[model samples]
Target: MNENVSFYRDTWAEINLDAIEYNVKSMVEHLGGEGTVIAVVKANAYGHGDYEVACAALEAGADMLAVAFVDEAISLREKGMKVPILVLGASRPEDVQVSIDYDITLTAISLEWVKKAEQFAKEGVLQFHIKLDTGMGRLGITEKEELDELIQFAADSSSLSVRGIFTHFAAADELESDYTDCQFAAFKKLLGGISNKEWLIHCANSAAGLRFKDRIFNTVRLGIAMYGLSPSKEMNKELPYSLQEALSLHTKIVHVKKLPKGGKVSYGATYTAQEDEWIGTLPVGYADGWLRQLKESEVIAGGKRVQIIGRICMDQCMIRLPEKMPEGTKVTLIGRQAEEYIPIDEIADRLETINYEIPCILSARVPRMFLRNKSIMEVRNPIIQSHSASKG
Candidate 1:
């Protein structure tokens, strides 16, 4: 651990780079000469740190990287990553030149956007992928004629190169395959007779890649599954291989007190002790991405499950301790402590959201400590870094 990286607040997210590497390798092996894996590192690799995750994925045999926008691609480029990066979202006309300069691939959603981008590219070829809106009503060209026009326009443009074509899956995680089949069929129809071997034609995301193995696309965009999370609860059991979770949240008790019978806890006094009990205050709350709705959730302390009591506050929450635990005792929020573990799925279920949202929702205020080979490799404390830089 870095000397500057102190556990001062005792709340931080631990990122296991080894698990990430393993997951990517497993996915790549599963592809087994069928296709390549485009590791999706968007939204900071689902809030597990993009640069770190990208490096791990690439080291583990990922063929390419995908982000939500051009800025993300530029960020990785600035960090000296030279892998093929594709922006999966629409880019501003003004920012088209940046993509060209960085050799980053942008997604061409419309002919109007493509024509506008041509105006911005002063020199060199602007590489991009044509996004086909097969079923995902999001960004992409839906009509076949529009797609044809875009392809012709790109071919005519001296500064544009159509490097790939792809589409999004609307519900590939679901049990029913009718909609996915229709989407894949439409994608195939859209690319009908365009047999340019160099053009990358892909449609499978993490869900589609695992579930629909019969339909092999040239590339699979590994997203949620790359982070050791299932696409959905229903699809968990059907995974071809087991996934290892890469992120774990932890904090320590900052304060401890013995409350008498009928004593209230937290704001609104929603929880009251029926008998004399020990209470421990954690330094994590909704502000740290531990949402207030998790008040009913349990955390591990001293190898025991402790119930979070009362309303969760902005910077603190009270947990009913089984015994008088001293301040600074470790608490496991979303990982294994001793023999018990609190999974992200459980937290997502309580929040009525998907597992993807759980980690992404974690606030930047909480520091992230990266681990490799069961050892701490780097600790990123934004708050501490900002404070130290201000002094320097």
Candidate 2:
């Protein structure tokens, strides 16, 4: 247990703020002022570091910031971000005043929770939005009678302010248009428009944002796409604007060993040397979000592509380097190097998941070095990467 030996090696994720602005510009250009994009910075801005991504997004003209919880909003607030933050998900009733103290808006569908919030709010003022369950069947007011009263109360309340009305699309990105249209129609019927209070009404997520321009809600919740990634494969195909992958995972080779053709590598001897080859160990692994499912995957090393040999370990993974490169060489798990690039989507596709999880999973233990214009712009505080995170 050496004091300075970092358990993580072999891979790390890179994020570029410059590309973030580009992605925001792409979406705004495609929108052409049809609607406002409320950038979703929840889940630590989808694992790209919430404050940094949120700052970058605001730099690119994102109108508002949305999060899934109160603490996240509080974090952005702590960073001195003066932009409006709307908690798009759960906010415990006990913490309503804390939310108010931070000037954050909480989402409420239950009259009970609203009443609780009203109790805690100072000056009887609690700015919050009501989430409607159009079809997602998630957290939101679903019953008609409840929704009507909630709307009326919001309109009449002196203590509560209805900042906006919104809903989620269950299938906005699918080619099958039936479900999306249904959700939209349901949301429209529920919110014909509130009188007296001119709140911004928005309901389009990334998928709905790109398609159904005529059906544009008052505001769009731009999540995955805002970070230069898409919600689904089909949407990527139909994207009206070119998207750049804002987050890149990179690391350097710290240790290289030349193994004979018969050498066994990693757990289970899953990978045997294919002739005499160079095996290099990176300083990070599945613990850092380099999923073990990518056991047979490849990472860009020394300007050339190399394969991850054997089962990915918990704190580190091994890649086979070429004779031209050795210890101390840089390996690219997500970004570009010379003529080769490993987009995050490729890894997601390889693992049968969405690209959103890649950066999020790169535990906080691995440091995120932010880049702007291809140079180190800033290094975020150390990621809380959990090594005990079930081994890769």
Candidate 3:
């Protein structure tokens, strides 16, 4: 073990901050100064590490940051992120004072929730954004009357300040524009009722901002795209700018052996060697987000794609090696090796999921190594940190 290394595991996730910065800059360029970009760093920046990605986005010219809830915003605040952060999800009435103390903006989903929040408000004004339910059946004010009432109520309350009004697009990633057009129309109709037009008006997420530049108001929430991923598989071809993926999963082969032709591998003996083949065991499994569903998935080994074989165990998995690879040979699970590459979308396809979930599902057991300009900047190992805290 290296003297400076704290984590014992060989499996790790690598995040390229340069790629994130590049992606953010590309989105800003795509906007052409017409609107501001609110870097969505919720869900730990979609599992890319919120603080690291948030700083990269801000450095790349993102104007604001947005998270899913109050706790996420507070976590950023505790990290000393002073950027304007909007909680896109509804916040609790009791947490209103906490948000105000931290200068965190929240979403006002309904008049009732706002009234409750106002009752809890103390000492400082609580700023919020009004959410309109254009078409999505999720949280927001659905009717025009309710929206006007909420708007007027905010205007009347001295403790509350409405900073923005926005809605979400349900199918903006699809090639068809009918649903998006309908939502935009509804948003416009709702906008007619509000007297304060200066509130930061925004309704476009990554998909809508990338596909429909004409429909954006003055801000766009940059989420998955800012991490260099398409909003959906269907929108891959429609992306205005080519995105550079920022995260890669990798591990070192800890053990290698040659299996006889009849030799079986892993838990269920589901895999039998067709020929005398070299097999490698990786120190990664379901606990590390390497699910059993990816039994036949391919990973880069020896500069070529090789299939994973047999039942995946809780702590390890086996892969068929093309040649005799020594222990500690680098294996690329979700990145490029030589001329071959395994994109996140490919993993998502194997699991029948979205690209966003791929990184988010990566468990904290795997240390994240952050990189900038191809050099490692920091290594965040949650396991080691927790262990140290327990020891202390």
Total clashing pairs in model 3: 0
Query: In model 1, what is the error at residue 50, expressed in angstroms?
Result: 0.5
For model 2, give the 10-residue run with minimal summed lDDT: 1-10
* lDDT (Cα atoms) of all candidates against the true structure: 0.90, 0.80, 0.92
- What are the root-mean-square deviations of the candidates from the true structure over C-alphas? 1.5, 4.5, 1.3
Best by lDDT: 3
Candidate 3 deviation (Cα RMSD)? 1.3
Cα miss at 2, model 2 (Å)? 24
Candidate 1 local lDDT, 43-109, one digit each (tens): 9899999999999999999999999988899989998999999999889988988889999999999
Off by over 4 Å in 2: 1-11, 122-124, 383-392
- The candidate 1 region of ten consecutive residues with least summed lDDT is 1-10
Give the candidates in order of TM-score, highest first.
3, 1, 2
Per-residue lDDT of 123 in model 3? 80
Window of ten residues with lowest summed lDDT in model 3: 1-10
Model 3: residues >4 Å from true position, as ranges? Answer: 1-5, 195-197, 390-392
Give the alpha carbon lDDT tens digit for every residue of 1-392 in model 3.
34565578889899999999999999899999989999999999999899999999999999999999999999899989999999999788999999999999999999999999999997889999999999988989988888888878888999999999999999999886589999999999988856565689999999999998988888999999999999998899888889999999999899999999999998878898999999999999999899999999999988999999999888899999988999998899999999999999999999999999999999989888889988778888988888888999
